[model samples]
Target: MHDHAHGIRQGDNRRLLAVSLAITGVVLVVQVAGAILTGSLALLADAAHMLTDAAALVIALVASAVAARPADDRRTYGYQRAEVLGALVNAVVLIALSVGIVVEAVSRLLAPEPAPVAGGWMLAVAVVGLLANMLAAWLLRHAQKHSMNVRGAYLEVIGDMIGSAAVIVAAIVILLTGWTRVDAIASLLIAVFIVPRAIGLLREVFSVLSESAPAGTAVADIRTHLLRTPGVRDVHDVHVWQLTRGAPVFTAHVVVEQEVLERGSGALLTRMQGCLAEHFDVAHSTFQLEAAGHEEREHH
Candidate 1:
């Protein structure tokens, strides 16, 4: 990996997140105050979603910082998993928030209450929340593609933005049609949007942490590639997994011809590693080379 590209200029994102975090905190406060002042469920729901966005951004900032740490003897793979862990945590929090929203929305639906200040205040707050969510989402967009932590944060903000838009539409409907159930309906819609994103984040993080082979990488293909290499007799015990979001690691036992053993087998292993890295994007690789008959005896 190129030194600059690996650790690159992350400070910009840190600074952006810091600014966005502060703004999000303010938005949460404002939205909550607006909710209480007007007794508006839409405002309250938006406030709760904003709180999630703020927490997600904080986690993303911390995870990105931790992931930038260099590898050490104790942590051979370094701290790249920090982003995955962050995503997992964010997903858990989102699920909890969704549960709370569902409960509140159901209760509100059972006995609908008139939202104070009619529709004007709700619309104003929803508009403000929408703008804030959009700004935060834009700020994190670039970093989101770089790490799972930011991706989780970006999704949260996007969900919040959608929720805000829903609230705005609900307020408009209430203003025109006087249908109060629209607020509860919008809350349910927001819950629907949030749940799948949370589940996806959880699944992706768990897969990476479990050392499951990444999507599109098949063990059979890797084994066949190794077996097809000249002087290689067979390949067995193949293992492939992600070292991080982008770097995949592969390891296998390769049976080689006896003549190749006398002649520098190290070169063969090096060539195999290069091939894996170049074609399969497997950065870290290990290969145990053995003579044909010795392979079965030697626990590959």
Candidate 2:
């Protein structure tokens, strides 16, 4: 496979992760303290989500650093897949925390507790958290489009941002009506928000690990494109998979007419590679040129 040449900023990613992680750590402490003082389940759940954000940022930072290493003889693909693993772990953690938050929120809803809450403290702490998560989310927004590793971190931060908003609203409701169940309701909202995103992230990571073709690609369409090229008789064993997010790799066997093989296969190879790159943006691909029906002999 050739290089797909995706644009990845390892240095910038690390810096963003570091800043986000530190800020999240601070927010976690602040929110946790606020949760205890205010007895706001929304604040508590947001704190828990912030905790996962910190871990995800750490993982993403390490993964980005590892992924930047040059390829070696032993590790031909370099360390790109490390980022995928980090993203996978981040998703799993988010899923776990989301479930726990949902269960706790449901329990609180069932048996409303007359918990004393300092609405002011919850609001103050959550406002700070909202700012931090918003900044972190901004840093990761562009990177998330092209990098699964960064997307994992971004999702965590965005989730916390939503949680912060929930906390703020819960604080307002509690202050106005003295209703404690609103806190549980806010936590449930955060949990509900987290589920679909966490599941989406997991699906992405799973797709990478399972070597599934990138989304929005049609194998049949690709085959048809290849067959339209001159000197190409058929295409078989076509496979496409992502090495990392935004880096798709392809391999295929192209059957050619005997005359084309006798003349030269260089032009056909060039055209095949060009078609894949032009149409599918698949720069990294391997093509095997074979005489028409050559696979029959191999099967025999």
Candidate 3:
């Protein structure tokens, strides 16, 4: 039953990500066309933002497929890290694009250009972009909660949505007040929306790659919990990290109670695994069980 449910979940994720990629691709094209036709800096920035989102969706689809591969001799941990690598790459791309947009917006501000289309028409396209972004966000919402790959894509869609809204507002202001500077301000606002998100995502990606402790799951706190469990004496050489987006893997050297070690080491290990799973949500764990006489204190 569990295996069947797991298979169904995997199928659902693949289908959803594929559909998201298709939608993002179509929206990116439309946004780019709208930008060119309207000659609106705001529209162009939003189009660029959607372009990054489309790229993220494509990377996520490929990364998910790679992550499903079985463990091999060269990679004993399997290909799960592909998802993290995908996120890291996406973050780098976003940073680059954000920098480019900021530079262009600054240049345009110094030397303003007339918008080709009337503000009302540009506003109409911005509305369409906004709707497209919302739809994309909904498609990836569930997956984002569980997977970093989806989260990266979700962030891009969210940033694009904000960019679209900013463009719409700028268009309205341009129409009402004849403020050509509004387009440059909107472009800068789009960069403001993107840069911070890109920086945060890059930090997460590097943390995962560096095997830093998973956020919100402190190593000392986990050790203390394990020590309180039955049959556990001392814990050492402990380490924890995310195996994938949601799954965490842990390893520790555990000194068992003399009686428990004498009776059944295998049973003690099994009990410890259960305890770790129940308390810490650690899905995979490796505990080196040590008997009392053979145990020696070790520091991390």
Candidate 4:
């Protein structure tokens, strides 16, 4: 039943990503042309940023589709981790692109003379690019809340929007002051906007890849809750981690009174699972009911 609902959500996410990709693709071509015509480093940097965003959206789109595949004998968890991997790749690409832009901007700033920039052409193209970015952002806004892959694409679009704005500001400054160096300065600002968000996303990707417990969920708190259940003497080997965003998996060895075992472990198991689902928002859980001192007889 849950699988059916998840499939529906994945379908919606893919549609959103596709539309956003189309918008970005169009803007990317326009920006590239504008950059070449105006010889504005800021416009060129923004175009480069859009190019990567378009690629990232493609990766995210493919990953969203792959994540819908069912588990098989060879891959028990299915392809859900594909989304995480997609996010990882997006973060790495963003960081690398930002660093490259920064390096180029620095070199341009150090050049003997500032590069010529056509402020009028740059401004017109930047305005169009900013509008396209705004549209793409609106399309992905809700979907990003549900999937990390979508979130990565959404962040990239937002960065592109900022880059476009910087380009516009640089264009206006150049037009008023005849200062071409503002173009390089705008590229630096765009790069600055990208690095921190990319690093933050990378941190989240690592957390999921390492199988760390989801934020705000404490293993100790789960242990305490399980121990409070009727007939449960102790809880050990409690493991909690997420397969992906919003999908948490839990496993624990629960020691219960012999009387409860004699009465059948079924009811106790149900109670514990219910407790986890209700309190911890863990829907998929496995508990091994054990007789008192069962762990003592087993080699650790």
Q: List the residue pairs that clash in candidate 1.
A: none
> For residues 16-83, what per-residue lDDT tens digits would candidate 1 score against the true structure?
77888987998899899888876677678789988988998899789879977888999877788888
Model 4: how far residue 165 lies from native, Å: 2.0
Per-residue C-alpha lDDT of model 4 across residues 202-240, encoded as one tens digit per residue: 988888889999888989999998888889898888888
lDDT of each: 0.81, 0.87, 0.80, 0.89
Q: Estimate each model's TM-score.
A: 0.86, 0.91, 0.92, 0.92
Please write out the lDDT profile of model 3 over residues 66-178, one tens digit for every residue: 87787789997777788888888889999899888889888877774554446776798899889988988998888887678778889999999999999999999989988
Model 4 sits at a Cα RMSD from the real structure of: 2.4
State how far residue 65 of model 4 sits from its true place (Å). Answer: 1.4
- Which segments of model 2 are wrong by more than 4 Å? none
lDDT of 2 by residue, 1-300 (tens): 254465677788788788878888888888888888888888999999999998998899889999999889999877889999999899899889989999998888888456677888889998999998998898778888877898899988888899899889999988899887888899999999998998998898889899999999899999999999988888888899987887788998888899998998877788888898899988788988889779787557
Per-candidate RMSD, Å: 3.2, 2.1, 3.1, 2.4
TM-score of 1: 0.86
User: Least lDDT summed over 10 consecutive residues: which range in candidate 1?
Assistant: 1-10
Q: Return the lDDT, model 1, position 243.
A: 49
**Candidate closer to the true structure by TM-score (higher is better), 2 or 3:** 3
